[model samples]
Target: MTDSRDVVRRLREGFAWRDTPVGVFADLSGWWRDPELLRMLGPSLAGLHADASPTVVAGIETRGLVLGPLAALPLGVGFVEVRKEYRVAGEGQRDGADPMLRAGTPPGYQDGGLTLIAPRRLFRPGDRVLLVDEWIETGAQASAVRRMVDEAGADWAGVAVIVAACPPEVGERLGVKALVTDDQLPG
Candidate 1:
């Protein structure tokens, strides 16, 4: 079993903490380079879906880009990237992604969410998908993507996150499972 507290410890050690105008933020660039963390978290997150047997794993842009692939590998499933506006070349649909998440730009993270445009064909009827993200704050992104999945006629197995700060109602409504919670963050 993945000790959820261990994952919290890894996150506290690997991520740099800060307070912004919006709220507390943790920079995850260093977390990506920490092999110990990658090793610890991948299977932990994938384990969240071990029983459901998801056919595809979908992740949001930026943070999810890394964690999603890692989780998918353990599950032995294909990975799909849910990207920011126009990030993916060729044909894709808009799912109203977070306008605050501008990669390689100042203030790279956003607390307030936006509608993201994702690929039109990420799923098919009866496709079981597990949505992955590094964190779940307001649950807006996950909720929006869940709507997309429903519209696509795909089964939303559930949402998995490394850490979550959303309220209990959000998690219940979105069917989210996380390794750690906002209250678990170490000082």
Candidate 2:
């Protein structure tokens, strides 16, 4: 049987890990430049959908955009974008105004470079959300998204990442399931 751990390992190996710079920003952004990275992660992410229980997916903006929808589709659930642009969190702000305005990444994320939004649009009061992202090295983005989910009054079902550089211990603190490890990436 195919296990999640194996799947994670496979996804990690899909990327050209050797090409990434040692720093956090460079490492994260560098993954985007490698086409093979996505090719590898895409299938592994699909595997996540196949194995997961039914649930709505909350994708982190920009990066998580693709990962979120792909996973949710297999589960027959709707996908929502958790934006990094900031908008006021209250009524009378013009519904459907600018979704991106309020959906920013969080402060202190990736060394405090990213700021997440205060409002979450794709959730109901009691909705269950499974947060998915491209990778989780520091958990900054994941934590930021979690805060947004909580602010939206949605229940966080779980967290899934395509690659996890830190071990399970680090992931556990941020409610992350490192479906794959950094070492799994191609050298």
lDDT of 1 by residue, 1-187 (tens): 6676777788877767788998887877677887877887778999977788888888988888888888998898888777665455465335783322222212323644344555556666798889889888777777667777777788998888988888889888877888877677665
Best by lDDT: 1
| lDDT of the structure predicted as candidate 1 | 0.76
Q: Global lDDT of each model?
A: 0.76, 0.62
Q: How well does candidate 2 score on lDDT at residue 92?
A: 55
Which residue window of length 10 is worst by lDDT in model 1? 99-108
Model 2: residues >4 Å from true position, as ranges?
Answer: 1-13, 18-54, 86-108
Best by TM-score: 1
lDDT string for model 2 (33-140, tens) is: 556554555445645544545368878777788878766765678887765543323445576664432433445555556566534456667877788887777666
Q: For every model in order, what is the number of clashing pairs?
A: 9, 26
For all predicted structures, in order, the TM-scores are 0.79, 0.66
Candidate 2's TM-score: 0.66
